[model samples]
Target: MRTPADFCADKDALLVPAVRIVVRIVGVEQQKQGDAHVLGATEPELKCGPGVDNDGYFDADTPLGPYYLAPDAAIRLLTYDEKAQRMGLTDPVPVATLRDVLKACKSGKQPGTPYTCSGGFFHAAMDTKGVITELTEIFQS
Candidate 1:
C-alpha cells in the first residue's frame, strides 16, 4: 500500500541522481533475519531506501538505493543494465560470487513476498550455480 511518494527513500552515497530500481532479496527462513523484510511479503513495496553497504548484493550507487516492489505487483524485467550503466543500473551487472549466489538462493526458500490475509506462498528453489553457469552459456552463444 506504499504510495509513489512513499518510495522516496535515500540511496547510500553514490552521489547519483535518484534512479528507481525495484530490488528483491531472498532470505533464509521466508522471514527476514533482521530488518531485511521491512516491506512485507505479498503486497508491492515502496523503496526501502539505501541497501546494506555493498553487502555483496546489488551494486547501486548508494544514493539511489534499491526499494522493494510489492509481491503482487506485476513488474516487467528491465534489460537496461547495458544501457543504464552511468545512470546506476549496471552495478548489479557483475555476476554474484559463487558463495554469495549460493547463500542468496538458500534464502529464497523463505519466500519473502507478503501475502493477503491468507499469508504467503513459498517460491523456494531457484537455479543453482551449476544451473546458472550452464544457462550463462546461452547468453554467451
Candidate 2:
C-alpha cells in the first residue's frame, strides 16, 4: 500500500507527464457554504501511468488520467442529499455538517465512511515549470 511518506519522498519524481498521482486527505476547512476554503492533504504518489482506468467512469482506451487529491480551494462541497443526485450538486453543505461527515470518514463510526463527498479527482493542466495552472474536476467521487 502506498503511504504519504512515499509521496513526500520524491515530489519532483512524481511530476512526469501522463503519470497520475493520488493524494490522501489530512484535513479540510470549508470557507463558504460550498467552497472549500482550505483543503489540506498529503503529497501525491505515482499511482499509475497512462492507459490505466483507475475509475470506471473513464473509457479504458482514453489517454487522459486523473490525479486524485483532496479537492483544492476551487472545489465546491455538496450535501448528502445533493450528492446522492449526482447530475449536479451545486448547493454547498454547511462546514460544520461537512466536518461531521469528514470526522465520520476518518473515525469509521458510520456506515460508508471515508466518504467522497469531501474529495474529488482533477484533470490537472501543468505548465512547463510543472506548476498546476488549471485543475478541472472530472469526477467528484
Candidate 3:
C-alpha cells in the first residue's frame, strides 16, 4: 500500500502519513495520454494572500505538486444548510461546481475573497500516483 509520504521527493525521508489535504485550485492542465487526455493540477504564479498554518493545506501560491484527479474519483460540492444542521446537501446546482471553480482560477483574475477563491476550496485524498481519489468542497468557518 502506498502512502502520502511517497509523494515526497526523497524516498527514504521520514514523513507523517496523510490521508487528506485542503488544496487551493489554481488551474488545471490537460495532457494527452495514449488516446485520451488527462487533467493535472496547477498552482498559482504568485503569493497573494495571508498564509495559514494548517499542516495539510496547500495554498494557491505554494506550487506544490503535479497532482492529478483520478478517472473514477468521487467529486462533490458540499454546502451546509444551517437550519438542517447538516452539510453536503444533495443539490444538483453545485454538481459542476468544481469545474467552475477551476475555470475561474484559470482566468487569472483574483477571487473576490481570500477563502472563497473561485467559489470555494477543496479537500482531497490522493493516491500514491499523485492522483486525487476523493475531492469534496469545503467552506470557511
Candidate 4:
C-alpha cells in the first residue's frame, strides 16, 4: 500500500490541514459530468481534534475547505475495528472502494445523516481550472 506521504511527495503538492468533524448532511448534489459530488453541510461541528481520537491536532483555526469529492480522489475508510492493530486507529481499510464511495456520495443523498469525518493530512493538487487534480487523505495512526 502506498503510504500517505507518497501521495504528497510531488513538488507541487499542497499540504492542507484536515479537521475531524461530524456533519449532518444537509444535501448531496451530483455533478453533471458525473465527476464529483458536492456535500452540503450545516457547518460541520468538530468531532475531535485533527488527528484520530484527538491523538494529534492540526490547525484548529483553519477553515473547512470545499465539501466535495472528486471522482478520482483517494478515499480511505478506516473502521474502528480495523484501526485496533499496529497500524493504529487512523490506519483505514478500504471498505468501499473509491468508485463506490463516489457513487454513494452522488446517489445516496441522506439528508440529516450523521457522518463522522476524521481529519487527516490531505495532499492535494490543483489544476489550472482551479479543480483538485489529486487528493489523498493521510490519517496519523
Best by TM-score: 3
- Give one digit per residue, the lDDT tens place, for model 1 in 30-79: 22443221222221233234553322122222222122322222221112
Q: Which runs in model 4 stand beyond 4 Å of their true positions? A: 1-29, 39-56, 62-64, 67-69, 76-84, 88-117
TM-score of each model, paired residue for residue: 0.18, 0.34, 0.48, 0.37
Let me know the TM-score candidate 1 reaches against the reference structure: 0.18
Give RMSD to native, each candidate: 16.9, 11.4, 8.9, 9.2
For candidate 4, give the lDDT: 0.38
> Which 10 successive residues of model 2 have the least lDDT summed?
55-64
Local lDDT at 110 for model 4: 25
TM for candidate 4 is: 0.37
Total backbone clashes of model 2? 1
Segments in model 2 whose C-alpha atoms lie over 4 Å from true places: 1-23, 28-40, 46-75, 78-88, 109-141
In order, what lDDT does every prediction score?
Answer: 0.23, 0.38, 0.46, 0.38
Per-residue alpha-carbon lDDT of model 4 for 34-102, expressed as tens digits? 657664433322232334453333333434444665565444332233344432222332323433443
Choose 1 or 2, whichever is better by TM-score: 2
User: For candidate 3, what is the total of clashing residue pairs?
Assistant: 0
Error of 1 at 111 (Å): 13
- If candidate 2 were superposed on the true structure by all CA atoms, what would the RMSD be? 11.4
